[model samples]
Target: MATTSGGDLSHFAISSVYGELLSEMSILTAVETGLLEFVCCLADGLAPQAKGHFFGSRNLGASGDTMRATIVLVDDISRQLGVGFSWKNENFAFLEKVAAW
Candidate 1:
């Protein structure tokens, strides 16, 4: 997968695998907001899903004399790369589009 990070939510593209999009994770579904709980349908129907924590945070700091540090919190899945991200809880999802693995 090729991921490009600009400033906010980065975009990821599956550089492999091609198949029918059985299901995908909703970009609006909050990883922390807890609004409408919607996960990847494929994961819900499948098993052997990993577990982990999904956290989105932002930080600011000053770099060297002519540099600076900045952090952007991506609260949404801009691209369709992210399926589900809660590994610790076994909550995961994945989007298998016209990609090749």
Candidate 2:
């Protein structure tokens, strides 16, 4: 995985967006927000980051419903984008159980 300093523009941009979304929107909890970010990372083909956020969400207490929704949304987005990747490994067993398909 690539590393970036706190001052990096991309890091700043992501932090800014999440800050605003979390503070202003005030709808999703931290775990849900992390899952949403995981989806974005997956969409961008950043598998390491996606994995980090997915597990981070779980660590932060993501519920089964939220995990299922995340899996379904990821499947929908991946299909729509013609993107292919595997999340069926042991590390993702928890997610695989709740996958919509």
lDDT score, candidate 2, position 42: 61
lDDT of 2 by residue, 1-101 (tens): 02555467666556776556554536876766787787787666666777777777777787768877777777787888777756545545545544442
TM-score of each: 0.15, 0.54
Instruction: Provide the clashing-pair count of each candidate structure.
Output: 13, 0
Number of residue pairs clashing in candidate 2, backbone atoms closer than 3 angstroms, sequence gap of 3 or more or interchain: 0
Q: How high is the lDDT of residue 39 in model 1?
A: 23
Residues 2-31, candidate 1, lDDT per residue (tens digit)? Answer: 234552232222222111121233543222
Candidate 1 has an lDDT of 0.22
